[model samples]
Each structure stands twice: as structure tokens, then as C-alpha cells.
Target: GRPLRVHSTEDGPLRAYRVYHSSWLRAAVVAVTFSHLLLALIEPRAGDGESYYTSFGSRANEPPDAVRAGLGRDVLWAELVMLLLYAADNMLKVYAVGWGNFFSVAAYSASSMFKTEKWDVLRIALVFAFLVEVIVALSTDVAWRPLRFLRPLFIVSYFREVRRWVAVCVKMIPKVFEMFLFILVVIGLYAVLGNLLFFKSGFYADEELQNFDTIGHSLVSVFVLLSSENYPTIMNPAFFRPDHTGSVWYGLYFFSFLLIGLFCLSNLLVPILYQAFKHHRQRLALKNHVRERRALLAAFQELDQNRNGLVTLARFTDLVVRLRPDIKKGDEDAATIAR
Candidate 1:
């Protein structure tokens, strides 16, 4: 259902969408989500993520009956019901967001909500959630079921920090790419050094040192070495063997690798994330500060209740009670029931 639009003046434009704005709706979303999460934590089904990836091809010929017997059927039905509700909720949001000029075909309908700038994240999320819902709903495979969890973006929207964190991370994308390029260059240089000092030195004549046999192998080996995965075993032959870089150069080579590969390039992420977070938080703070300038005025507009130009005290109190329901509490019973 369309929410009653609030405007300061009779002929003024509508303010914001309020279809999904009720506290009851918020509580329903939180309640349903936690129920599903609790069910998911305890219920183990046959077609989970690991089983799907590892056994899908092999089990392609297996009958549906063979996959699960009793309890899985119950879980599957519950999941389908939830997924349908999720899809329905997304459809309601589409209507809530977009304005339709039913009087004129010149104006777009519900789909036109995407054109507006303010609700871009919610718009993208609506489409993505619906798509995941449909895909999961049609398929019996439980692996795709995990995608249904993303339908809660609307719930998470109440916490603005998620959006702030996303904005900061989006700003860091270029900086991250720059760091990646530098790391690749360092890895490439070390790969060439491995090719020259080990493979070219005839270390590959022994099968034990075959990892350094080619430039590709040398590149991968350098990556493994930098990660410190089985480091001593992978590099000990090159270090101790007199035919290669030798014991004398071991400390200098590995130390330089650590200094360049692990320490220097990796540390850049810390400052970049910090800087992005700081800038985003400042932007949100300033935006909120500007919005607060119009706070009482906007509240008065909403409080007008009737389409009249000015608000009386009674209408003002009604709007406050409507907006903040906590003030409606009368006794311990009311408070407990509210909780």
C-alpha cells in the first residue's frame, strides 16, 4: 500500500517513500532473518556448498531421491517459502521507491526508480536479491541457497556504517591496484633472479630442484617463498648448494625478499584504508550537519498532518508520537509487550 505522503504545502511535491518505513516492518525483517539464521546454523542438508562444488559433476546422474531422504525435504520447503517472501519484499520496495505518472504515459513506472541518484545502492540490491531468489527458488541445489542471505541488505541499511565502509573501500580501489602492480613487479624481478641463480646454474639437473626449472616455475616458487609457505624446504637447496647463490647470500637474498615483498608493499594497505575511512566519515558528518539545519522545519512539515500551511500543537504531538512510538508507553505491561 502507498504511504500517506507528507508535504508542507498542499500543492508541494512528495518528500520520501514510507511504504517500508514502519517499525513493524523493521521488526518483521529482523525477526524472520534471525529465525532463518538459527535454522541454518543447526540444519545440515545434503546439497551444501562443499558438496555442490566437489560432487556436482560426479553426482549429475544421481536421482533427486538419492540426494536426500526425510529431513532435507522439510528444510527445502522452508527455504522456498522464505525465498518467495524475500522476492515479494523486493517487489514492494520497487513500488515504494518509484513514482508513477498514471495520468501520462510520458513518465516511467516502477522500473524508473533506478534513474534516481540517491537510492542507487538499494536499487542495485533489489535487483540482485530478486535474481538470487529466483535462481535459488527454481533449483533444488542447496549450494546457491547461501546467496539468499544477501536479501537482508535492507535490514543492514539501518546501520549507515556499512554504506560508509563501502564508500571508503570503493575509493581505495585504484590505490589497491597500484599496490598490486608494484607487488607484481617485485615478484617478476625475483623470478628472473631465481631463473638466473638457480635454474641457469644447472640446479635443475637434480630433480629435487626442478621447481626452478623454468621462468614460470621460478615465478610461482618466488610467490610461495614470499608467502613463507614451506620456506626452508623450498629454498634450502638454492641456499646451501654451492652451485647456486650459496649459504653466504642466503640471508641477504631472503631478507631483501621479505623487506620488499612482504613488509613494504603490504604495509601500504594500512595507511590507504585509514585515509579512506577518515575521508568518508568526514563527508557523512558534514552531510548530516547540513541535514540537521532543516530538521525542525522538516519535522513541522510532516507534523502539519492536515495539508494546511501551519501546524498546531496537537498535530505536532501526534506526529511525534507516530514517529517515535516509545513515548506511547504507559505501563510495565506496555513496555514488556513492546520489547
Candidate 2:
């Protein structure tokens, strides 16, 4: 037989969060987020990152102007409309939260501020997003089209970890940018040095000069060297050729660039990412723990025979013994478990 049912209060405190508290509403928000994400995924950027047109190619043989005829024509305006919807949704959430806390606010507004802070962050982010969208929408430059791709942020509202992942990326940007600057400086410095050393070694220098004569060319050469393409052509003259200086230092130059530019910079990214993922994992573990605790309590509530808080030991014993006949009443584990 099933365990007795009761309205015992031992289950837990009321789980009445104001925003997205309704299951149906939460599901709706998730569905909307997924739809927005799908729209974002299908909409391809115009060639060279232009914004006005995109493709939803169903076939490789589709015409070039396929996007201009279909979703691309209206996708831009549609995105703006979606942004408006998101803003309105956020606004409604704020209103609901405020009203839910109205009575408590009258009594102790300062202490009760926690209730609305989540919505406040949401509102601010949405407002900023709206402003940026409007600016890009009104702009006439091709560059602004790429900014439209940022619409995927629509998913953040539905997924907590996505939001935190973005936050961590934002926080790590400064350090990562600093590393980028360091590498840029290294490339520029090496480019100059290489051009000076190899720019006009001899008559053969002209033949050897694919990307080492000018500053811009040297920059490209250094970048290409990092990729290690046609590397033997660049180094052979400096070391093996008879008219060459025969100084093996060119090997050291390229080697050091590979060492500092590629190796060191890659190592720096690992820890920042590790810390972010570790923090999110810990958060997920805590979230799962609370959910499991609630489920266990809910199951216990189903077994509680009376409306009063605790389930008596007699009911627990009867329930467990019936559920598991192998565990006799006299077994110490069963007795302890029932107690």
C-alpha cells in the first residue's frame, strides 16, 4: 500500500519567488529564448559582414541573392521587435516583483531590497542592449552589421550559466587584451628587426624578398612565420647560402617569436578558463543538492499520515517493511532506519 498523505509542514518554507515563479511562465520564457536563438542561428551575415541581408540556404545551388528575397529583408526589424518584447517582459517582471514586496517594503524597505535586485540587473542590461541596438539600427555603416550578431545574448535570460559565462568573459577581457597587446608589440618589434637584417642582403635579396622588404610586408612575414609556412625559404639564405652572413641567429629569432608569441600566450588562457568553469560547476552542484533535498522532503510529505509536522516512527516502519519484504522488522538496519 502507498504511504499516507498529509499537509505536514516539515516539507520546507514557501518557495514563492516573485519573478518567473509560475511554471508555465518559466516554460514560456525558455521557449521564447529558444526561438530567438533559432532565429539568430539561421540568419547569416551578409558578405564582408554587411547587415541588411542574410541567407537561410536550404541548398548549395541556391541563388546568390537568396537572402535579399527572404528572411534577410525583415530579420533586422524582427530582431528589434524581439528586443522590445524582451524589454517589456523584463519590465513586467520588475512590476510583479515590486508589487509582491509592497507590504514588506512598507515595513522594512531597506532590508527587503534583495527581492528586486535580480530584476534590476536584468532591466539595466536590457536597457543598455536596447540602446545599442537602436544605435546600430540607425547607423549607415557596413561595420554595424556585425553587431547584430550579438543578438544571441537573448539566451542569457533563460540560462543562468550562459550569463555567468559571459560575465566571466567580460571580466577576463582586460587581462586577455593586455596579453594581445604584448604579442602585437612582440610581432612589430621582430618584424622591424627581420626587415633590417634581411631586407637587402645581396642581389639575391630581391629574389628572397617575398614579405621582408617593408614594414607592412615584414609584419605579414612575421605573422606568416608564426604559422611556419614556407619557412625554409626565409631561413635558408641566412644560414646555408654561400653569400649569406652564415649567422645561425635567424633560427634563434624565429624560435624566440614562436616561444613568446605562441607558447607563452596560450598558457595564460588556461587558468582563467579553469577558474570560471570550476566556479560554475560548484554553483551547479549546489543547485542540484537543493533540488534533491526538496524532492526527498516532498516524498516524505507523501508518506506523512497527519497534517502535523513529523511522521511517527510506526508509520515509517510499516511503510518500509511493506515496501521491502527482505528487510525483516527485527533487522538492526531496518530498526535504525525506521527510528
Predicted candidate 2 versus true structure: per-residue lDDT over 1-339, tens digit per residue: 112221222222112222335577677767766766676555554445543332334433454465443555465556566666666666554444444453244424433322343434654586567657555644642324444555555566457667667766676666467666776887899999988877776523544345577888788778766666766666565667765555666778877877876677657667756665677668767977876676678767877858687888877887777646578877777778887
Q: TM-score of the candidate numbered 2?
A: 0.50
Residue 313 local lDDT, model 2: 80
- lDDT (Cα, tens digit) per residue for candidate 1, span 1-339: 222433222222222234355577657756765665565553443354533233334454564343443344455467556555555554554454443432223333333312333333454465466556545634644444555455455445534566666667777777577767878998899888767666655545655533677888878877887777766766666667765556555567777887877777768867876776677778878977765655655656766768688876555455545545457634354444434
Error of 1 at 74 (Å): 3.1
Error in Å for residue 44 of model 2: 8.2
Candidate 1 off by > 4 Å: 1-24, 34-70, 91-160, 201-210, 242-251, 295-297, 300-315, 321-339
lDDT agreement of model 2 with the native: 0.60
lDDT for every model? 0.57, 0.60
